[model samples]
Target: MTRYEFVARAHAEGYSPPKEVTFAPSTRSEPHTHDQLSFVYVVAGTFILNTDRAAPAYQPGETCLLDANVAHAEEAGPQGATILVARKSGRVAETG
Candidate 1:
């Protein structure tokens, strides 16, 4: 989806306004947990997301939603990655 669409959807889902984040080439983050839900939209390059269940590569136009307190790590691809992130506190709503 386009950035505009992503922002609109995120907001509709109760996410806060997005903030732009850029990761350096090949950068890696230690495993961590967030107090709030995280909504990430890959804007450029690639983002490799690691979690207990899986590790997936997210390319531009892809999105990832992480639940509150979930353990996760991230790595930037060789070309690095730029993403838009939004957050929401409390529990996320259930979907059918």
Candidate 2:
């Protein structure tokens, strides 16, 4: 497995605020960290979310929550995949 290099800029769709990213077939991303808490929703194809502790496969419609500054990586399935990534910076509201 090779380390994936992440681009500095966020990929997005026209007129849309959220970042949209696409992976090439058999693509593997290098471990990296995000500036803020984020969520990645898998729109098509499959991928594996790799972290320091675990690696889990994510399919279409599956969503993953990533904490701010957490180091992680991603591996795309053979057909590649499209994902929507949104970010936020704040504390989550607690339910009592």
Candidate 3:
């Protein structure tokens, strides 16, 4: 469950908690799902994200928003990556 390391973590009043995570070069995460919505902001290096909808590569300053329960995987670039992520505490079930 812990594929990356958290360099920093903090919470703000009335806001979702934020974390800074770092992934080593060539590191990859197993397919996983989150119970809360995820907002990720790339800070340095590159990252490749594969989801049910698409497989896209992201660079520094790029951002990705993933809904809750969306199955996905991630891989760090050759130079590794550092990202800021905020996990909104909510189920946010998908509606059809």
Candidate 4:
């Protein structure tokens, strides 16, 4: 049988995996690193993203590309944020 999904777990697929991550009204994750990564669609309410200071503050529909090892932090804790991130397991070749 064929199934349809609006959201899936990241563990389902190693690469280009789909996951539904939910955040509370005020939640922020610890700063982390990914050698090569890209964030696809982010359905957010209200949040602030931190990057190398070059990237502008993200808002709804505002997409940004983050380089590897770039110190970054985000605070959606104030009002809460939900983002669906997608990344490649290996070094990033290209992102658009």
> Per-residue error at 54 for model 1, in Å?
1.1
| Candidate order by decreasing lDDT | 1, 3, 2, 4
Top candidate on TM-score is 1
lDDT digits (tens) for residues 19-96 of candidate 2: 678999999998998777676777788978889889888887677767777789888999998887767663234246
lDDT of 1 by residue, 27-58 (tens): 98999999998999999999998999999999
TM-score of 3: 0.75
**What is candidate 4's lDDT per residue for 8-76, written digit by digit as tens?**
433353436644455676665677766755543446665556675642445554444455666676566
| TM-score (C-alpha) between model 4 and the true structure | 0.56
Q: lDDT scores for all predictions?
A: 0.92, 0.69, 0.73, 0.53
Error of 4 at 57 (Å): 3.6
Model 3: C-alpha RMSD to truth?
6.5
**Model 4 CA lDDT for position 95:** 50
> How do the predictions measure up, each by TM-score?
0.90, 0.74, 0.75, 0.56
Alpha-carbon shift of residue 93 in model 4 (angstroms) = 8.8
Q: Which residue pairs in candidate 4 have backbone atoms (N, alpha carbon, C) closer than 3 angstroms, thus clashing?
A: 27-77
Model 3: per-residue Cα lDDT over 1-96, one tens digit each? 121322132243222656788999989899999887776778888988889789888888677777888899888999998887878755445456
CA displacement after TM-score superposition, residue 23 of candidate 1 (Å): 0.4
